[model samples]
Target: MNDFELLFDPIREHYRTTFSRIERLVNRRKNYSIDDAYINLSIVESKELSSKEENFHSDANYTTFEEIYGTKRPIEIEQLFNDNRERLLVLGRAGIGKTTFCQYIVCQWASGKLFQQFKCILWIRFRFLNDTRYPKKSNNEQYTLTEVVENECFSNKLTDDGLAVLQFILGEVRQAVSNSLPTILILLDGYDELSVCEHLQNLIDSLMKSPYQILTSRPYNTDDLKYDAQMEIIGFTNDNIEKYVNNFFTSNEPQKSKQLLTFLESKPSIYGIGHIPITLELICSTYGEENKQHAITSGTTITITTVYSKIIEWLCRRYLEKFCNCDKRHLNLKDRSEIIEDCSEILDVIGSIAFKAMEKSSLILDKTLVEKELRKVSPKRPSELRKKLLNIGVVKSLTAGDDSTNVEAAKDYYFIHLSFQEFFAARYLVNVLQNPKRKCYTKAINFIQYEKYNQRFLLVFTFTSGLLSGNDSLSCLETFWKAMTSEPLDLIGPRHIQLIIRCLEEAGSDHRIPQRSLWIEHISKWVECAANDTRDHKPLQTDSLAPN
Candidate 1:
């Protein structure tokens, strides 16, 4: 009869028994219903991130993707909503498990183990709202909070009567001063990716005014959207990393887990980068590849780039196994390379889609777009390859359509993570550049160099640099470096600083760099630039690098 019961029952029933993917082998993927494998990464209270004064400058100096932007003390995920801390914002870098953190909170709440103070918790993924499939209310009026819950969050679309109940409940939720009535908490996921003009401002404004809400996003401008409290998912510590590796490997393969930890221990840089969840997954999964360890260990160096590239290569080998009906692991190097070379077609199509989505600042694309992009590359109907590109687990489905029925149905897909999209985009650009005969090669090269230090494309540039450097294609990346520091009059902005920092990060411990960078190799130069400019007409701000 009550609103909370009406909403919570449907949500709990639909999601309480959700399935998880247990990645056992690089070649095969199996899905089963269980919920124990999530490795709880450290979600620490974010220190008040300094303004554009280049806070990442120090964090960037490390060779590994070292943890940054959080307090020394880590907080339990549940602690986020505890102690009257309602208006909370959770931030993390790309692929740092921000959504997983939110989902964990959801799982906990649904199990009646957390946020007991509220009658129900509403989880909203802004990514879904950005999807074209999700019904858009209208352009003229603000979208109703009721419509948002019914359309965006609810597992099953609400009936007319149910929507009436929610509309009434929301009215009380906003006005209630005490817990005499049923109270609900809101979890806003992907705020950074939210397209604010989606007539959803009313919903956002309502949530902003409420004391019972949590917003999660990739770290962006805190100054734009302040919260009562903020937390950052800084990825796993060593102990948790060990636990994840243990969980990933089966009981029958315990020694394999031990071997991975041992390998990571020996390579501190690789281990440090493993703090990231996706990188850790790639590291563990690819570890099973034939000669993967030898390749990782034998290299003069290895970085996240090495891991990402190997995993894609690994996916190619696995794909070949299905066709050849043989163990790809047993294949010789020459044969494997030849098969992987053949698989470049799949990569080209996937990368084109990824690049288009990135240009639109979108994280998800529907099947129509995929087919359209595929058609441009291949003359035939790229139906089979399209399915492979999507279902392959790297570019994952956003709208988890009935996989048992039609994966090709009206489905929305996203790269496994934003970082994955960036990797594919970068890889695609490299492919284009490597092929001088391609008509777009010059345009592609120019785009990478002169993206105006696009904050959204920072990872793209970093990955591009890493790919070029990792593959001995440094000619392009060095030019990119020159372009980054080529602000007129050497007046480097924070954007420029971040671009340089991230690209340089990809440059370090990157398995292929012949020499290690001190990282501060630019500090002396930066200081010289700073002092070079002192004209009163051009008074410099602390947040910017200036010159005479």
Candidate 2:
């Protein structure tokens, strides 16, 4: 075999096995390929004017382009990658298909369908690298590209001959690099997930000068790095959303898929979230499992928070059923009432973990930490509980080593999506508000005040507001005003102020706030304080200020 083929063959086989195995929903029997369920999303040039900061608004602005432009033309994913050649950076919001785009590139390169200009492609995930604790020594003993490849791609199946072949291939790659040949394409995924490592920084610096490389990160600006070309992953268009929903439901239930399309067409608010692929999947899975007759017969309006709440409920129900049916059944509830309680417990435990992780700005949970946390909640087997979570797609395993090592030692876990993590974190906070004995109200208040949680600030606030507003016995207005005003006015940021205004807007004109003018007077005081404290404060939107 040629040196390129020698290096590419195993890498292709490795990723093909890893990427193709995808599970769609909680109770689904069949798995789909990455390409089968993939919706081809279009990308636009990352203009300075089109950055995320411009899009941040009180109403949860997640658009890709500015409002002045009607629509800029989009380029195909491959064209965007190929156009940039060596140094390309892909930026997107959380769950907007950045990771999936990286996977698609790797899959395409592995199949020999794209990037024919390069001899080898290296796929590196910073999440794993950061978790693995790389750079064992501070000196020049940094990991080589070959070591990374062997560890990530071929560590499980490498034989003595395979090791020798890898060494030879590494030598060939070094020779190609020194000869100034276009021989490598490095795919660096999830830069934001990594801890601050100087070695990683140096490696990124070297890759910037390499012949071919591409990097993906959630939308954030940093002075530490520069790129030749940058593109943002704009999510699905209306047509693409329709196509994705059709693909998602066609195999299992065609009629239900049609009904889902109809239902989404009727509800613009929920339909807007369908433009995001992850939220789109959650919608399909939740709607598919719903009793269609009841949904068709009921007259209730479905909001975004309701959609996520139903998803969580569905996941918990599916998990409980599966656990009861398993051989080591710990939860043997008799009726719906018992099951409901059990489901709440499950969500509480999982939500607590998710909340703690988000506070620390981390995603992956070490198995040991998971066990420690689970011990306080459930005396029953924590591993079994974790397995149930894995089965339901709440948390997924990130297995590192081969089957020889203990699974706990070789594996880490994280929520399936950052959105889900935020949802559960909000759930945890809501539970705290509902029950004071949990005694973490101070922590929750501090969490909301911190700037690190600003990315998910709107989501958590909205969910908490929805929960409070839905309960008749609870005085949502009183509770909300007290919770928001507890912190000093000067300490509150503009995002928090905007969030409060949005929540009051949702509460409507007739909400039981005693007097609308009084509540507005309090909010005006907070806004005035915010304005005086920060020079960058912008006026709150008129719509959000309206009582209705």
Candidate 3:
């Protein structure tokens, strides 16, 4: 191998070996490879992604893009990397396919389908960058580009020879910086995910000097980085959503895809989240499991929370089939929910893990944390329980190796995606934490119900509120909702409204009918809170927000 081939062979090999194994986030039963399911995403040139009309008004109103911002120049997908743009940014909300789009670019480039001008493309997920703790060498205050590149290529952490090979890659970047003839493309994804660190900040600043780079982040999370061009990934359009449904069903058996589209159309709120690719995939999988789609679409208005809860039910039913060799076919979701209750012991343990991770605002979980929680649920045989949960694919373990290794490739565990983490956390919040049976529930409850809400737990609280009105009678959340509403008008801020409204949105507006007294109290408190800035009224009694 000559100089260039020798330098990039590892990245090429790493992509080849691992890319196919990469599952679409929350894809059920390895249903489709990304290649078969991947849609070529279109981008509109705009600075704003969030909707102005959406406020604490309602939760069912998924964000609609409305802004005064204008698109300066639009570039087609084909010409995205063909020109000489030094820096570009792709922004979207959670689950809007930012990471998937980055992966698609890597796949295309690896196959010689795009970005041929660049000699090497380095795709580094900021989560990994945050997970990695680079030792503070006296000589090096920041992480080296070569080391970062080698570590995140999804290969075994290179201990020794990785430096020289990737230094050659860096050498090309160095030339491009001076000569202004860019030869490398660095794709830094999820900038918002990286934890606070001085070394990582320095490293990020260093890497941003690349002559050509593409950064992806949730909207407004790109404060630290600069870009020449900014594009928003709006995810699937109505037509694109239709296209995804067609791609999901290969057999076209029983016309399941057609049913899913019709179901989505009837429920436009559900249709809004269908724009998010991962949620769309789960909706399709859950709907395809049985013909009882009508029971849901025909019955009452289902919210996003209802969809996710049904997916969990689907998981339990599938677990019975795959693990226990029990097959109960064509049963309605209500009947199938008994399976979830049957599996509650295991689900509780997993949900606890999810809650703890989310409480810390982290996706990565330490191995010790996993074992400790596992022991609580099944002390007699934690190992067996661990195996079952891993097999079920909720929590995953990273490859175990030396902590000092480049990838820091130790036995760290993480959820399949951030949203699942939040959902399961929400489940635990309603079922266990909020339930009064547990003696120390008061101590646990105070942290979540603090005066100024922890911004991180907003989604957790939304899901928590949604789960309250779900099929299971979480009558305890009646008190939970009252406690949320009973706060002084001064304590009821924008986030509080967001939390409650989103909860109402997810649970369906019809949910408030039975709890009319509580809803009336909540609306009354909110109306008072929104009107007054009460220094005259005492500030709320708030405990310090802590992470698990």
Candidate 4:
């Protein structure tokens, strides 16, 4: 047999097993399988990207280039990879399906539907690798590509014979590479999550030199990275969004699905945001639950903050139903009332943990840390609460241990999505501000004024401002305005001022609030500050503040 055939023969079974294992693991962790949740979207070729450019600024020409080369003629994901045989970088905004695209590629490859030219494929999650610690070694020591593959891929479920076959394949591939023949495909996912180091950079550089390699990252300044070609994962089109919603609800609950689509159709604002797959899921998941169904059809105004709030409550309700046997449909009126009260109490504790995790910049919470945080709120039954959180998909297992074992076997937990954590954090702060007896109002004010401008706290700031302005109570609006204006002019950056402007705009647009004069007054103060260029407030040259 030829080298490729000999290497592929024994490992084919292992590959199939790995594919099934990954499908199950991803479905379990996400609480939905890709086949069910994925929406096929168009890929836009980035004209500015070229392999010859040593330093490519991804965003420098983005606006002009996109206008020139609109997505009118888009390409398939497979075509993008096939055209760029050497190196490709995929970029997209958060919740735009960069990771999902990677999973889809793996699925296709495993099924022999795409990239048939590649004899071997390896997917590496940079976030997990970044968190993994390796024992110190001598300066001369280095890790090999074969070692990385064995540790990440072959370490799980492979028999001795399967492992031997993998080693033989790697050996042959290495020889082929020396002779300038391509044989492997490497996919590095989540480049932004990786903390850069010389070691990691060297590895990336080596991999980029390979004939087949792909990397995915969120939109950022990419002048430091090297790639042969680049593509952007554009979010769903209106037609695709409708199709996805139909598919999501067709087999499960057709009536509810129609109601959701009708709701989105009526509200153009909500439908605009639904173009993003993650946001669409949030909308569907919230509207699917019986308690939150009213959120869409009840004529209550829905902003991003309100949608997130409903989603948080829905998640908490799911947790309670799983752990406390409190499914509302099966409970009597009194029992339902009690269950809601219990869920409210439990939600406060989970929100506290989420707030602490956000403050620490730690997205993944270890079991010990979760227990400690839970103990702060409920001294007893922290373990039970943790299990419930996991069951409801509020917090997912970061490390997949034996599924046959208890979920407590997981070493770490993280909020299913970063947006959820931010929502809970905002909830915690809102509670603090609304409590008249609490002295944490100043703390909340300081966070919004100082820390919110940081990228890490951007979501927290957005949610906080939305919640504060969305409230009809004059007291809430007064407090938000006061805190925003009280910051010294020198301390407020352009971004901070922009956020304040946004909050004022939201308050003015909120029809429930009768007092537009108060919002106008605060808006005037900030406008004056900008007019005078006070506090070194230079006009922001970007279109980041354009109305969405």
Candidate 5:
């Protein structure tokens, strides 16, 4: 056998076995069509790939905001067309129905309603431009924006001679409309994902005067500019949330639905999530299944953490099974320990690199982090790396944001969704902790309900230098811990271990073994060791600890 086959043989076998076992556990017998799987995977693939010629959002199934939320931004969109000479810019958070709204306008034009005056409609997502820098190699499986646009626009070459191509397309559109036949309407979705800065802003500026452009972004501008009309796409309001809940939970009495609605109402963050139809779909799907058993189970609260966990769980159970099965049978990593280790290695690679979670949820640290963290246990990259991570459904390329204009800012990449960060942090904590006692799970449960920052878990590691064994592991944990301890939780810098300790101490009055007590002795021990081992350094958790 060829060397590549020889190497793939063993790893592939192990993966298959591991995946099989996982599938058995989940009882997944039915097979999914390749097209169906690719359709969803493509949505994720599109966001993960940062390319110039890609239109990742083109085939993305989107629902109208008015249909889904019953709130129309069409009037506002139309007003811009009527009054403004400049293009219309619609900016909002992910899942805020940006594409859906654009589609709605297109449909309106087709039916001779809202855009009846417009002669033609052309819709393209800004996601295509993300890949302008990275051309696809023949062997590369990852889809880029370029490939997407080529397929969607029904052309091999992008309209890429800069403004020349755009001008050509615009001419065709304009010609169609100017015949008094209709106004040409062009929709550019996910303008935020378009990373080519020089082209993006300038193209936008030019399009503004073009009389038929509509663009959407997450939140309003970071840069100042004038648009003919700018409309903010807030998520569904409480009424819609309530209606969604009521409609889904037909079996549940109105009272229960009302209670759940009240619960949803109390949290405004849900609005941020509900802006995306997929987020709404996930929430409604989970709620529909769970509500039949129990109305608003404590876990059912639509916190970002809960939503992400469910998705990750689904991915692990559904897709990872095949890889896990292969690992078990071929790699001979039979026990849970081996499985966990293998899993950790996979996560390590993914966590190291800048990856996007599916659904534009979060960006993961790139493979570089893996290189940094597991230099000794080096991973084969490009294909092997992609397969392992994608198998687990943990990491994907978030739509590439523009490399920062500033030198310093350009170095870091971001996950499409912030919630992925929280998920990554939480998973790492669970995996690294030396002990897997049920108490940690209980503590996690309690932490979600009672603890504000999950201090006990944070402090336990903070005080114990050896909590994570291995130099690399310890260094990784310590870096995160130090970053955490340096900043207040509210400020979003690092986890403030000191604050956790302080909170723990304050809880002592209940006659309960204060959570702080658990870590103080351990921390004191570490401090004593540090003093002996290195006289130059002051004790940790000292008053001198600078606030992050």
Candidate 6:
């Protein structure tokens, strides 16, 4: 049996004994006592036995005790019952298993295995409570979180008054506690999600003072927690990641298993980031079946951006086919080339300006500068587009305080999540530069050539594509090639020129381009050097001299 199983044995026995005694007492007066009297009597009698008091709070309901501890084994039950108040806080990047860990703890506690030493377990999902539409609730019912908790505490109890059911639960809990049977353990998960609510501070204060309580939250702006112990879930270490990968691969396809591992190793930033188990599972499971063979044969990194891009691509393609086909529902919509051009121009301008700020300068530009640059294109709010960028994880939003108005600090709005930015930039570049039948290319070429624009665009494009691996495919290269060749390479410089040639070479003999052989000789020396060190910087002159 597991450690948790053994720890539960005594608690289980105690509960059994308590139930037997309560049953015996009820049997003796079954006929004489009225239903209400019996209810009160049983509650009163339960208080005397102290069946609930022994460890109700220690039962591990609301808090994610196990995840916070980073273990599955049962901890010494006595340790949690420490008299001094300590706090544990969990912090990590987005989509890095914070919430999942919290849930795992709830499952353990609910099972009555690990935290059985606690008298009562209470679990709360702060988001659900905070999200309740207070405006629609009864005018007479203004409730603090504590008041709400007091009500929910008695939800499972027997109560004659519907409005006072929660109070009844609390009463039962109090009576249970007064008996000094089991210690109570309260687990509060996603404190960050709730802490934003006006009532949350008060609720936290109440919890801190309570004899039994634990809380979990995101690390941002969540400093003060009077928890008995402070535990931060820093995510899986490299060993933990390897262990999880090994476990995951045992039953999965060999190719998908290999692909995910390759993906994990390719990017330094996302090494342990994707190992959140949820993200890894989502990426592998979503893309694994369809491309299992390809993934196995070709080493590819699965980045959060690439995963999101795949989903978006599928969505766009589906909608495009559905709305505008040769057959049914073809809304003979006027070819609003100008509108498309306008939108493309806006995106291009923003991409160019943002690229300059992110790539060329040593000093990072603030949001105000970014906004100023964007204003040159159109007066429309850039915040929405910025939000879209953040949503897709291309550029993360950083804040000084937890409040919204804080300007992004240094390295704040970068394309470190290369795959996601590639998805956006590649799409935007194609629409702007590769439209075969439009005047957009002429304007785009002119725009790109204007005053150090090439350097900015190149930096933007390269840094954004660095994180892409197998799944990114050759799409970005094709898009870039099409853009570069449409105009003279001299305007853009040799680096972009070689970039185009390199893409053509990698595109292989399938495309039947004579330019591949012609340029390969010109680029061979630099290419040979790059073969040894892919990240080594090459001179712009080398790029210009290398054919084209």
- Best prediction by lDDT: 1
- RMSD per candidate (Å) reads 5.0, 5.8, 6.3, 6.9, 17.0, 19.7
In terms of TM-score, which candidate is stronger, 4 or 5? 4
Better of 1 and 5 by TM-score: 1
Tens-digit lDDT track of model 3 for 182-224: 3778888886566655666777777767678888876543555
TM-score of 1: 0.83
For model 6, the stretches where C-alpha displacement exceeds 4 angstroms are 1-87, 136-140, 144-183, 195-209, 239-252, 266-270, 292-304, 311-548
Residue-level lDDT tens digits of model 4 in 1-548? 66545445434444545543322111243344455555676577766533322122332112222342363357786677564357888887656677777776766676788788787677776655533232224584655555556555543544576555565555535564455443778888877555444455655556556667788876554557778777777777777877877766648688888878888889766776677677787787667666567755554455667676656556556655666677566543333235446676556766777887777666666567777876776677777666666665567766542322355744567776667787778777777777657676777767655664455555566677677665556665556545554434334344454555445443436544333454455446656656565345444322232212
- Each prediction's TM-score versus the true structure: 0.83, 0.78, 0.79, 0.73, 0.47, 0.41
Identify the superior model by lDDT, candidate 2 or candidate 4. Answer: 2
Q: What is the C-alpha lDDT of each candidate?
A: 0.65, 0.62, 0.64, 0.61, 0.42, 0.40
Clash total of candidate 4: 0
* Ten-residue stretch with the least lDDT total in model 6: 37-46
lDDT at position 78, candidate 6:
31
lDDT of 5 by residue, 274-333 (tens): 545446545554444432223123432344344544554444433445655553233332
Task: Order candidates by lDDT, high to low.
Answer: 1, 3, 2, 4, 5, 6
**TM-score, cand. 5:** 0.47
Better of 4 and 6 by TM-score: 4
Q: What local lDDT does model 6 show for residue 526? A: 46
lDDT of 1 at 70: 30
Q: Against the hidden true structure, what lDDT does model 2 obtain?
A: 0.62
